[model samples]
Target chain A: MEKKKIRNDIILAVCVLAASLIALAVFLCVRARGSYAVVLIDGKETARYSLSENAEIEIKSENGVNTLKIENGKASVISASCPDGICTAHRAVRYGGEVIVCLPNKLVIRIDSASNGGVDAVS
Target chain B: MKTKNIAFIGLLCSVSLILAYIEALLPPIYAAAPGIKLGLANIMSVFALYKYGAKEAATVCLIRISLSALLFGNPWSLAYSAAGAVLSLAVMILLKLSGKFSPVGVSIAGGVCHNLGQILLAMMVLKTIGLGLYMAVLAITGTIAGVLVGFCASLMLKYLKKV
Candidate 1:
């Protein structure tokens, strides 16, 4: 192994790492558009509701129950029958790709930005 | 391939499979987020790519994913793993052939490519481009995991060469 090659590799690694970090920083600051909440039960999506809509949904499964609430363009799990209740404790999510998971109940509510500002064609 | 080379590939394959099994037993530390892992098996993949060449590295990666699927994953996971491994291996081979980056750099690129490949597949299956948001956090985590895996591979390669 040439020492020169290793030095070059280190430089390349730093450049890529810096580039990825900038991308992440940009993602954090960007405002999401046309976002919605997706309710997944056992890894399969059960329903999708827009973030622009304010409503409450009670998702009951054999595992347990979780009440997902969308209000003021943000989503949260306000209540659940699961033992952990980590989802309920989580902060309300307004950004795309954020999620509230009721693991004990196998319920996942993830926030996704339609970004295109149009209704999803999957309906 | 020589008999000795074949044996080395087989050895790396089994090692990678064992690493995959061990990784499966770890808790999902990220809680609500899934698919985060130490990727210990990738150490062998990176090492083999740098040491034995692309053919052997590809063999190591394929066998690890296949054997791990048999041990503890379903068909769905097998599909994702295969896609990630293939994409990662392809990028790693390209980087190696270029000799423009060290093993660590190549591993980092491989790690990011693996996540991207899986995310692209998920977007296609879900029929929505929304999955791009998930890639942000994953990108950060993937870089960390890649660096750790790469550093370990660096040490392992040094030892193997001496042996």
Candidate 2:
């Protein structure tokens, strides 16, 4: 009985691992390249920048400040005044519907597919 | 519950809190996935569930999450932790009750659910579903962390039973 229980547990763990790997693969393959970076502060749209144009955007919220850098069709938080700096530590993202959020600063940077003749319309 | 049981649960709670404290001290494992951590404290929760059932496990998990949040986290962190802890414990209890999976399997479910719960909360609060990809990243990390925590918990359970 004990051995059977252990076997069941092993099967369960394997299932979880397999499921996660499949999810990761699906996300990676299905993601479309983003054309724009949309910044929101306190759930309000503050700014929108095209990913094609490499630029640095500084966002200031009531809580803190964050510097978002868009270079080479990807967006990343290069710097931040938030205590944790979690946003700054995040990797750059170019996939449509990907996000980098700074909870401390109430800042959110989202990558969006181009609405005008973009991936969303194709799919 | 007996006084001894109450005292033991309190002890388990403190142990879990210490695990949380140590986890906080460690830097984030992957820069690309900011929330990924060892989830070391879950060992205690899984242990409590196997030893004393759902009620004791929930008590230990809640006290640990609440106290750690109060001591080392802000309001936002508290919200995230509370969401994760509640969902994780509930899933662990349900899996345990199913009687097919061992503690390791149950712990794995707990770990994944915990990450899912936190990510769901973040998505709701941020008002965007763009976190879906991030959730995918976390699911993998959470599964790996779950295996480690479950292994340790199962080992601890073996020794504790001999006591």
Candidate 3:
């Protein structure tokens, strides 16, 4: 019984570790610092701004209000009237593929580099 | 349904909802990741599945998601949580039926599936494949959270029998 229990433990440990390793690899692959910020309201592109040009944007969406601030080549939600305020809680982001989503407001702020092409026909 | 079953299921639903509320109170450990949650409420889902069977588990999950959404979240969050719950529950049921794993294994599987479901929804809503770039991070977090949740459920199963 003890041996069988050990086997179960080993099997589970291996599976979880293997999956995590793969995930870590993928996580590294899709992340890089970017030079622009894109905002989407209700799944539609509403605005785009350069990371180099520091500015604050106030977005009035269907659900509520959010204020996105870009400064020091980093973008963040400085304030939001949404109940959760999760987007505001997110740290200043300067990485490509990093996203801040205000689920309550149906708002998304995505970061991408200005040096490379990112927005595609599907977007 | 019998009166006793209704009361029992209701009690489980309330407990899960309370867990959800408590989870919301906790701060996110990672500033970059918002959706990573302990999913402590899933303890009851696993219990319901093991004790009263899949149908009871499904009922408990459905009520818990709906009530918790009404109490704490907006329409968008409601939609996201509902989709995640459904996919997670379906995966859990399949794992349970396979009979190859324990409650701990089932909960882990459920947790991972839940993250995938939510990620897929987020990608679609954002209209960007870049959203998937962070999925690996979520997968790692989900696995850790899954082990914690699964551990709790296994312990609870040892004591609690019926939903």
Candidate 4:
């Protein structure tokens, strides 16, 4: 019984660890420096800003409001009216394909690569 | 359900709710990871699954999620939690039915699937796939949280069996 339990533990640990490592590798490979921060509300493009500009934009959605700040080529949520404040706690994102999500406000700030023409595609 | 079963489910629900409340009061486990949670409430779900069955476990989980959301979360959070609960329960049930894995394994799968479900819902809600990057971090945290919750649950099950 002890041996079987140990084997099961080893198998599960290896499987989960391998999966997480693969995901981590994918994340590292896909992330790249971004040029624009695109804000989407309810899956619609609401605003876009360049990373070079240092400014704070107030995003007011039907649910609540959030303050997004872009500085030092990174964008992050400075403050939010939502309860969890997960978005505000998220680290600044400057890499393409990185996002700061405010679920309560249905707000998303996604960094897009220069090559992808992220917000430009919407325009 | 029999009165006994219903009462057990209610007890599980309240226990899970209290655990969630305690978790909320605790500080984030890691500053680098914004949304990582201890998932301590999952102990009740695992215990319910082993003690009663999947239906009872799901009932306990659903009630806990809805009540917690009503008390402390917003509508969007409700959506995320609902998605996570549904997916996590489904995975855990399937793993349990396989009989190849222990409660600890099932709980690990449950924890990882829960995070995956939430991230998928977020991606859909935001209309962007970029959030998928966050899963890499969440998966690791989920595993650690899962092991802790699983051990607690297994111990509880062992003690309850004697009772």
Give the per-residue lDDT digits (tens) of candidate 2, residues A1-123.
778878987787777678777877887787789888989777677788999999998888888889999999999999999777788888898887778899777788988777532542333
Location of the lowest summed lDDT over 10 successive residues in candidate 1 chain B: B27-36
- Among residues 3 or more apart in sequence or in different chains, the pairs in candidate 2 whose N, CA or C atoms overlap within 3 Å are none
Tens digits of per-residue lDDT for model 4, B1-163: 7897788779889999999889878876545454688888999999999888889889889999999989877787789889988999999998787766677888888898898899898878767666655777788888888888889999999988853
Best by TM-score: 2
Model 4 chain A lDDT-worst window of ten = A1-10
Which digits, one per residue and each the tens of the lDDT, describe model 1 over residues A31-72?
A: 564378888777677899988989998888878888888999
| Runs in model 3 lying further than 4 Å from the true structure | A1-17, A26-31, A61-64, A118-123, B1-7, B28-30, B161-163
Ranking by DockQ: 2, 4, 3, 1
Between candidates 2 and 4, name the one with more favorable DockQ: 2
Cα lDDT, model 2, residue B35: 80
TM-score of 3: 0.84
Question: Which 10 residues in a row give candidate 3 chain B its minimum summed lDDT?
Answer: B126-135
| Candidate that beats the other on TM-score, 1 or 3, i.e. the better one | 3
Cα-based lDDT for every prediction: 0.78, 0.84, 0.78, 0.84
Clashing pairs in 3: A32-A96, A34-A113, A35-A113
- Residue B57 C-alpha lDDT in model 1: 92
Residue range B1-163, candidate 3, lDDT tens digits: 7898788888988898899899978876654476788898998898888877899999888888888889877777788888889999998998788676677777877887888888788777765565664566666677777778877887887876543
Which candidate would rank higher by DockQ, 1 or 3? 3
Q: Model 1: runs farther than 4 Å from truth? A: A1-3, A32-92, A96-123, B31-33
Report the lDDT tens digits of candidate 4 across residue range A1-123: 646754675588678878878987886887679989989898888888999999999988887999999999999999999877888888898988777888778888988889776454764
